[model samples]
Target chain A: MSVKLKALTKSIWVFHLAASPCNNCDIEILDLLTPRFDIERFGMQLVGSVRHADAILVTGSMNRKARIRLKRVIEQAPKPCFVIALGNCACTGEMFAPSYNQMKPLDEVVPVDAYIAGCPPKPEAMIMGVVALIEATLAAAKK
Target chain B: MKGWGKMSDKATAKTTIIPIGPYHPLQEEPEFFKLHVQGERVVKLEIEIGYNHRGIERLAEDLTYDQVPFLVERICGICSCSHPFACVNAIEDVGGVEVPERAKYIRMFTGELERIHSHLLWLGLAGHFLGYNTVWMWAWKYREPVLDLFELMTGNRNHYAMFKPGGVRRDFYEEDFPRAARLLDDLLRPLIMFRDVALQDPVLQARTKGVGVLTREDCVELGALGPTARASNYCIDVRKDHPYAAYDKVDWDVVCTSNGDVFDKVVVRVLEMVESAKICKQCLEKLREVDDGIDCNLKEIPPGEGMGHHEAPRGEVFHYVRSDGTNRPVRYKVRAPSFMNVPTNNRACVGYTVSDATITLAAIDPCYCCTERTAVVDADSGKQIMTWKELLRLSRQKTERLLEKYNSRMDRIWT
Candidate 1:
């Protein structure tokens, strides 16, 4: 793996972008930071700004109002930014797929590097997804 | 959209219009708040919601009556049980379905367990807002067990999907009572410790006490429900007032405090967790007494309208269902407690500074997404002065200053 890409895996600052989610996945994301799960131990932190983010954690289905903002947020992030779709809604649009208000899944809107699937994925599953994403990035960088 | 245009009227030369949210880091749900600030104090506040509106009510019209419970459960992840419980009750009310006695106890048990977890989650966030990261960590640590209990009982952590029209989808077996009761007993120790810490800690008291004073009159006029109303001694709990599920059978007090401050709200919730734990323990014991049977036997819903309300962790979760003698509901309406409590911020936030305002707004235990970005625009020059990060930094700084002040005062008294 390239040194630059290896460095990226050490500490990934994620900016959470919610697009009208049911909040189950959103809360689970927050739960990861709490003492029990402590995703910070893996050097993952939730930053307040997209500009400071290395990875974007997207939750919920892309709704009409949030679609523009979601696109803008993704665009504003620096290049080499990884997008992780954090729930069933974000990954596939779930129940919101049929709704007129919802636009599309996260992959259709933006390239998703990793997908964590659960109605709201458990914190353990979320951490493993991030780990897998890091491994995938390392593999790609090596080639 | 309705209140966004009106914010311009309040903008004056000295006033800086600070827009908090639409997507801000402090909020958990997406909501927009326009704060008309004169100096550091918020003079007038305008709230614009519907950013999180998913048209769940409209979607419910298409789903069958049985399918609506699962749909309603997704409305708010924290209050998942409340919506489905209320929906089930409403359907039962319409169809005149008699739920088995044991099912009522199971419903109440799960509902109260949700309350315990929801309140703990709010407590953690409240601590985070106050710059007490330890409190946030500890509160969340304690909250995990409650969620674990939820996982054990319902098979899922947040969305149980257990509520049906006439009764619950799952039954709490008689054999499971002892183990469940033990877990609940373990939960009480940490809850009591947290309660004592909140009550005795001077820093928390200084930060919260007399900060967000929503009087009983303002509470009633604004139609505040749940702990927001109970904090002001308004005395309205759907469980106590309406007595749905097995709440009538259980003996528990509605935790209330006369002071309408943020501290009282914290006290009310912390104490309510204790009461909720008690209710859970009692329900588990009652499960042992009742004989096991079919949880629900609801086949069809008749043409009628029924209203059901459950005291969700936030406040009263009201569901109105109109069944047109068909499988699907003609019209279904859900009113989350945050719907009523968010508007009361208009009255509660007038005199407080932005820092205090943050805690005050949070004191209602708002169940929306986190606030992300805030921009301060100078009305006279029409220039943006402060960004979202600056505003959040300012709020945190104010909390630190208050904490220092309170700490020194305590030191002086002790020495």
Candidate 2:
């Protein structure tokens, strides 16, 4: 009932999908929540369930198994969901592209809204990406 | 195809089924296994994967070799340096490019830094899984220095893209050497503190002591390596055995343990972290003493196939690469550390209670999600399943939940 609620409109909830990541990105993503690079300060979170997120944070280059699970995850998310690709692997196949196992850039598989470049972008950069997405969303709302 | 017929022909062949993974209290990832138990122990097990398949391998074929390093490094952020190191090493070998001596030290430095951080991460996770939240919190708290060091070197905590084909992309200046030294020193003190606590903590000992027991014989038979295999008295460290990068010049001991259990593996990693720090210290000294040279000098790759193996945090990571003198490789194969550990999951889980099985499975540090993300073929028909609709649904659910959790729950009623 207060105007303070208006200030919270730009916050975005992110659901991180591993998508056959090497486990390094998965851990760092988790690390973002562990006080040092706390995302909650920016109103970001790694939601356990996909049914509650505004944007999807995807890691790893898509692989066969990751594609299946990621597809399921992406499908589960609501419409107008912002997708952020965390690393170069997810942005493009990277080194595993020539390998028989990996799938190409996550954009080829899912509709991505923003791209954060880094092997695994720092949690700070990751948080910035979220903020950028939220700003984009708020700007869109004004339009 | 071997099925239930492979079971022993005994009078009491009754097997009780216990479903594991797809979410366990202790596990962070999902993998389902149907364990057939006779009495109090497992007689057989049928593994069911496909929980986290994202088609990583299929995706690899489409990326360029230069571009592949970043992707492969993302395969496991904890061991980010290992994958790219293996990939680039193979590329350099096939391409016949000579990396400068200075870059070799930097590569070794990053590799060891990865090992230290990875081991600490595992220690924290293992503690969390064992209900030792104090250790979990403390270990991660101490891990900050290493991450800081990583940031100092690569400008990012994880995914340090410091390596290139000929040598490396990063070069350490004179001033950076002291900063790295100070960071390494800070990391060493906390590491020693955590090491003592991890070894002496009763809860950690009780939860991980006898759980996930992989005997020496089991380790050898299962072909386990790294700390997982070394915990069972397997003195195999690819760095020591194969001498990759600048490991031959670095003086450090390959930490080994006798009892292959969760506790033993924990000890091995803790000790390994110290050893890595020692190697890092040596690396720092070398970095200061080493004269100027190129980190990497890219060259054209020739047509040939070669194998490269490096000891990653989990175990030995092997890569096979073939180049046809092109910017992209003809073939690239990555044998992740988890690939070897996944097979041994059964060895640790069998004959143990369901709870023990869960802890044991986690102790092996199996990346089940990554392992299952691709290769989704029907068992009977071997038919491929398109994942678009399913993924979209999951994405929608995740988005909705995120909105609710963050208190942004579709504020149409806000005004």
Candidate 3:
């Protein structure tokens, strides 16, 4: 856990992977880069390519079609990359869980390190999720 | 390889095809665009969708009438209210239940505010596409206050969940009026400034003006809706043509422009925001005077078929529901604005330079999440010389060159 935090020594580049999302979480993710939330100021930024990402932020309910693409994209990320499940769909599949098209919730398809709750969590909640990710690793390293 | 091997048999083999999508930042959703470029100009465009499909219509059949509103609200987060607005309208139409007069005003108020926020979001993305990062930042900065208003009113920023079959869920409190009024009043001066800057700015004009022309005939032929059609002078707004909720009750002019170019799309939206603000102001002021209670609770919907559509920020969000005297709808169909609007991009992007194609594709503000579930078949993508960065750099460089040209041409352009 502490070794994964080595990437936290510098800014963390997150690649936004929107599977079969409603797009509320995607917009809320973008909201972080806006003036009010501005995650870049805290040394977190969204990158266009997965190869450059230190962590992959996964959103959506992991429908069958997207599940394939999500698995392929996650496999393409560099080693030691962390996967964070965003929104209720990604964390627990929420209401969309029963749909025939929906695959397993995100964690079932890919290893997930952190989870952010909310149908589409507020920008503040996402920011806190990231901070908690770092804090948890630090606390574990102290042990 | 097989797909392209077959495609290569045509003259298209001579043209370099660039595929954008599935996971491009420009799309933000999973959809694909295949641009056939002859040198610098796009000769043809092919679009593929359905990557985000969660089978909402199929799922709607399983949910009861009461639970369907929440399901539809997630169709597109930005249009969360618009979806439910149309959903309830259809359910109400089926039941032949009349919405409360006060609820009409409250629903209109939320829908109008969503319009303002959605437009600003598009404006910000439009700015980013043109490499006017400052405008992008500013447009989004102004949008935060609108999101705050959504949170204050509906208790959630994205999915308002304000609508049900008979009427609305939340009541407009008089105590909330002053703050909402102040927000609208505060929004005016900046919006006016934004309109002036967006319309009159030389750099923006050079980048967008006369680019991606979707002729009025083209718009009609393609069945484009909302600003895409309005910009082309097609002049069809559901709010004006078929008034529902409080649209007929209130007075606000539908904003339209004749040019049918990318600039006209910007003009229609920028001007439309001012009009939306006026509607919000009117709804709030009149809501204070209306004494009718909200929610005319219709316990059960009778067996019948009904259809309802709202003029969403993007275009018409239509819902068709059929009841069999059961709590659940026997059949449900959704026709989102983007489903109609996205095809216009195929017509609009053609004949434009590759640099201009991105903005044109985005000009319709296509919501692939909403447009998804229509159709999708995997295509074999070949190697391409262009990356998303190269296309962005091409657009930015064009603006830089135009900036340099205009700077030298103007007499008063002293910097």
- Candidate that scores best on TM-score: 3
Could you report the Cα RMSD, in angstroms, for every candidate shown? 13.3, 12.7, 13.1
Please provide, for model 3 over B296-415, each residue's C-alpha lDDT reduced to its tens digit, 9 standing for 90 to 100.
Answer: 878988877789999999999899887777799867888889877877776788888999988988899989788664433344532223333343365467658845754454323223
lDDT of each: 0.82, 0.72, 0.85
Q: Write the per-residue lDDT of candidate 2 for residues A62-134, one digit (tens) a residue.
A: 6565476678778988766778888766778665566556556788877788888766676677777766766
Per-residue lDDT for B124 in model 2? Answer: 78
In candidate 2, residue A131 scores what lDDT? 69
Candidate 1 ranges with C-alpha deviation above 4 Å: B1-13, B369-415
| Best model per lDDT | 3
Give the Å error, residue B285, model 3.
1.3
- The local distance difference test score of model 3 is 0.85
Model 3, first chain, TM-score of 0.93
- Give fnat of each prediction, in order: 0.44, 0.44, 0.67
Q: A29-109, model 1: which lDDT tens digit per residue?
A: 999999889999878899888898999998887666677678888999987789999888888987767875666777887
lDDT string for model 1 (B1-415, tens) is 7865555534434778899886778877666788999867898887754446566777888999889998888877888888899899888998777788888888999999999999999999999999888899999998888888888889999889989887888776666677788888998899889889989999999999888899999999888999999999999998988887778889999888999999999999999999999999998888888865646678878776788889988888788787667799867767678767876887788888888887888889887531211223344653333433355477578658845865565455446
| Model 2 residue A123 CA deviation in Å | 1.6
